[model samples]
Target: MRTTFLVIVLLLMRNDAWSFVVYDDSKIWNQDSITFYFLDGTSQQKNEVKRFSQLWQRYTGIKFNFTNKKPSFFNFKKFYKISFKGKNNESTNGAINGLIQFGNLSDNIIFRKTTILHEFGHMLGLAHEHQRQDRPNYLDNKQLVTACMKNQQQSRAWCNENLFKKFYKKVFIQSEYDPNSIMHYDISNITSKDSETNSNIPESLNNSLSFTDKFYIAMLYNPKLDKKTLKKMHKQDIREQQQFEAKANAE
Candidate 1:
């Protein structure tokens, strides 16, 4: 059973690594900039988070201000605090009174960047792309649920309840589904058995925001930008991103 459990963990870590789920009462930040305080993390870790979070600010009008000192009063209800307290990576789905946990990605620079980007996606009021109600056609629910339930790391009941609340729960906020969105989980082989199509789940994980991600974020934060201009800008961003990737690969 130990080997079986280990295999499950490896599959989960390599395949469909999870993200933070939003609370029922979570709300988007109505203001332009968000201020964050680190409850626990090294200077390097906080710096990496700040750097990655700036990507969102570049696209949307949202800004992240990281502070070393805590607020004078004990009112997390109005503040955003991050820490490495939880066993899993997660953050509140808005500016609610919640904590963002770093989990196991504390030392991994690449993964730390990815996880921070993902959690910040939540902090900006985005839900998991895979959890969109329209995702059933692309995923195998039974296989995914079974995998989560059988994992020995968490209780079966907790797994079932949490998976349902996270993945199965539907949010009508997004109109279209984006598999390559930074908000999506890396699911490779967890599709439904009856899926007639290949699903074509991306083998490579999303390290940066997709064009669609940028467009929607702009839509949410800066709605004044016309759709036509956003699309043209998205195309330009995509070209620049591809060039950057090519140059990085050649290095």
Candidate 2:
């Protein structure tokens, strides 16, 4: 019975067309046709791929060309991808999704939805907003700072301010930092003396993708890969993936 349920769940992730909401103010000006090549992987992994593609299409007004391809050594590097594991001891169990290169968790239920969108954020080249130098006022925990300092790249504690301008032909409001964003995380194991003041950060750890996740993906949807944009996004993706793998192995 469990196997049958898993099979049914996997089948849903394999499909191309899916529906979700668009909560942004502006309509995505999807200007191109984007293609997704899904490599052999689990249902959660494939569903993540589909969720991202669907979000990208809706937010960017781009037509998505998708396919499920046999696993290949180079396919992930060649296309947008998501991979999952049953046990990710690196972070929270049932932590659901995280950006692939940024971090990994002890995988549990199907948090494929959040994982796909967050990783796609990395693919779009946005650094973690919590690490912004201007965030000191917003974040008061010394432990959070230490953890962020230890993982500077993943935390995005320091990134070039103009990072996005280099790749975008037209800059939109997607540039602003949004704490409530599904991509954003709440205060984790770190706690504050004044829960009243610090409680603005969601009490529970969160990974659900928000409206902004859908918006920029739609904005950057280019059917014909923009070499410059693709390169920039991929560079970040590879670097973050390496970091996650390194961290995972160290444990």
- lDDT for 7 in candidate 1 is 40
1-251 per-residue lDDT for model 2 (tens digits): 32343344345442332121111212222224434455346665565566544644444454645567643565333343333443321221111222233134325322444455554544444444454433435464544554443433333332222111112222223245556454454544323334343555555334444444444443344323444654565466446545745665576
Query: Can you tell me which runs of candidate 2 are displaced by over 4 Å?
Result: 1-31, 64-78, 85-110, 136-140, 145-176, 189-207, 212-251
Error of 1 at 191 (Å): 10
Task: Choose the strongest candidate by TM-score.
Answer: 1
Task: TM-score for candidate 2, please give it.
Answer: 0.44
Residue range 1-251, candidate 1, lDDT tens digits:
32343244334442322332222223556566677889988887788888878878877676677888886685534568888666888887765766788866744455566689888888877777776544645354544555554442555565444443436443323345666788876554223334323344445347678777877666556666677887787687667657755765576
Alpha-carbon lDDT, every model = 0.63, 0.41
- Candidate 1 — worst ten consecutive residues by lDDT sum? 16-25
Clashes of each: 3, 9
Clashing pairs in 2: 30-60, 30-61, 33-223, 59-218, 60-218, 88-106, 88-107, 101-240, 101-241
